[model samples]
Target: MVTYSRAALFILVVFGIGFAIGSTNLPGAWYAGLTKPPFNPPNWVFAPVWSVIYVLIALAGARTWERAPRGPGMLLWTAQMLFNFTWSPVFFTWHCTGIALAVIVAMLLAIIGFIAERWQADRAAAALFLPYLAWVAFATLLNAGIFLLN
Candidate 1:
């Protein structure tokens, strides 16, 4: 059985990875340069929401890893995480909202596949990804809107 400390560490690591990726000085300054949709969320909301999602993602990954250490499901999870990590830099730092939208769309599809695969291994793992998936779907639409508005 995986100890609570390991699980906590896993979550912290995932959150840290997200923080590191988003920590680029360019994002905060560059974000101000972009034209955002009126519906765009306040800047402060992103960190908190993403923080929760990252924790969920890490927990799901730990659970899935415990069940199926070397499986396609884990690969999909990793792929989605890679996509997640890349989007912030692309959109916020590089100001490539269109390309970021494309990346997120692909990411949403990959996460769906991950959920489907994880469903067979651990239902809780699959369930845990639901909020992340939903958030990404909303994010994809937001990305598209931002691209259009800007």
Candidate 2:
């Protein structure tokens, strides 16, 4: 039986992986060259918000994994996670905002599907994903704004 503490630790590890991937040799200089939208948040805001969201995402995934180890739900979770990890490299390092935006849309769809499946297995897991979905929806708008402005 997985204790709540163990699950929490697993979530933290997942969040750390995401944070490390996002933080490594980020292209801050490259970002200055792009024409961001007028409403773009400052650079600092992104790290904190994403950190919290990633933790939530990890928790949601862990909950689902506990309930259903291998299934369509897990596959969708993995697909979205892969997409999530790739977005930083595409946007921050490669400066491919347009491509990243497209990938993010795909990621959003995968998460929606994952949540739909998880809703049946564990409603808390599905609910845990709501903030992530909301943030991604906001991010999609932001990405579109950046693409248009830049």
Candidate 3:
């Protein structure tokens, strides 16, 4: 049985922490000056997209935690969240695109690992990660593009 309180707490923590970190480490003049790829979405699109993604991420995490707190799925979920939280600071504040790319790649890998780990045990958790994976893949390309161009 899923615990509503635990799910709500995970959702709030995931979304709130991500929003706080993102708001604090927003793209500034440096990001604006970079030559972005044509595929890059407008700056305004990120917040809403992330808002939805974070909720999905939280739900998957809560479900995985419920199923097996100490399992590989939870480990991958934690790994991805750590990498996710690290990217904005490295890319926007510290201005380390190469390092940020590395972080994001690791994050992408962790997300894939999470999905694979959850596939047999919890298909819903795995399904929840599909959009997150797609977005991160696109973001990885964008990061690589920016690193190459600038």
Candidate 4:
């Protein structure tokens, strides 16, 4: 079983890195200038939603890492995290929404693969990633819609 304190620390680190990455290029004029889709969430909604999602993702990562200790599943998890980290820089910082969509899609695929790979080692690990997959899938569509609308 994974230690709760260690798991909590892992969550904090992951979310901190993610939050830091996201903090650099906020929804400034560049974002305001874009043609957002009707379904695009209001500016106020993202923080709460992403805060929850990041915690879930961190839990998934920490649990999987503890269970498998850098196995193929962890590799996929790392891939997903990389893709996760890349999107904000591409979209918000570089203003490359199209490329961000691609990154999100890749993240979605990586999460799916991670789910499959982790399932064998720990069902809880696989289960933990489910929400991350779902959110990314939704974000993929949102990204696509943004790219299309813009």
Candidate 5:
């Protein structure tokens, strides 16, 4: 069983790092200048959505860690996090929409992989990732839109 301290640590590390990266790589003039898709959400929408998703992600990670620390599920979780962290820097900082699109796509795949890898062994952990998968799928479309429009 995962202790509360372990779960709290996972949540803190995951959300804290994601928040820091987001704070650091904000969309400024460059992003403002880009032609966004009609489906693109307002800037304010991202924070709340991501905040919820990050908690879900952390919970899933903690569950995965407790069940299969060195298994494929954990690997996929780590990959998704890396890809997740890379997206803002690639899109906002480097200003590479095309590369960011690719990054987001990879992230989406990693999310799916994590779900599949954990579904049988830990259905709860896999279920926890469903929202992340959905959001990233939408984000992938948004990224593709931005890349194509620009």
Candidate 6:
């Protein structure tokens, strides 16, 4: 169903912001220099995976906002976004894998909190985050393993 409503605009704006942030934080020279585990995905994989994840995130956020404006879930959502924005900078820009793991862990927890709290208000909204939650879980493990290996 095509939507041209406020929620659609909100989701598009969120997606644009997320896309900009992620595009600017690409793992350039600093990431290439790092040691990687055998399971590390090829560099090309991240963009597609994160693109889908970001769409899901935008949908989840817009759903939650539609259900409850200025609510606790929104706070959790903001917290997750804050920490989400930190991971790439910490890992790629700062070259601090360990700190990046911490950042992802916090982001994961915030996603969980957002899901849990959001579920009460909008089950569909909470359900939308399941994929994001799963991805972050995988990312947290990957980050942890990278930190330990390198």
Q: Clashing pairs in model 2?
A: none
What is the C-alpha lDDT profile of model 3 across 1-150, one tens digit per residue?
568987898999998899899989989999999999999999999999999999899999999999889988899999999999999999999999999999999999999999998999999989999999999999999999999999
Using Cα atoms with residue i matched to residue i, what is each candidate's TM-score against the true structure? 0.91, 0.89, 0.98, 0.93, 0.98, 0.90
Q: lDDT per residue, candidate 6, 1-150, as tens digits?
A: 224475567678767877777777778986787677777889888888888877777777777676666889888988998998788878877889999999999999999999899777788778888988988998898898889877
lDDT of 5 by residue, 14-97 (tens): 989998999999999999999999999999999999999998899899998998799999999999999999999999999999
Instruction: Compute the lDDT of residue 83 as modeled in candidate 6.
Output: 94
lDDT leader: 3
In order, what lDDT does every prediction score? 0.85, 0.82, 0.95, 0.85, 0.93, 0.82
Q: Candidate 5 local accuracy as lDDT?
A: 0.93
What is the C-alpha lDDT profile of model 4 across 1-150, one tens digit per residue? 778986898788888898899888786898888887777778897788788878877778788778776689889988988998899989998989889998998899999999898787788888888877877888898889889988
Residue pairs in clash, model 4: none
Worst 10 residues of 4 by lDDT: 61-70
Model 5 error, position 146 (Å): 0.7
Candidate 2 versus truth, CA RMSD in Å, comes to: 1.8
Q: Which stretches of candidate 2 lie over 4 Å from their true place?
A: none
Error of 1 at 94 (Å): 1.4
Which is superior by TM-score, 4 or 6?
A: 4
Q: After superposition, how far is residue 101 of candidate 3 from its true place, in Å?
A: 0.5
Error of 4 at 76 (Å): 0.8
Q: At residue 80, what lDDT does model 4 achieve? A: 88
Residue 25's lDDT in candidate 4: 70
Worst 10 residues of 2 by lDDT: 1-10
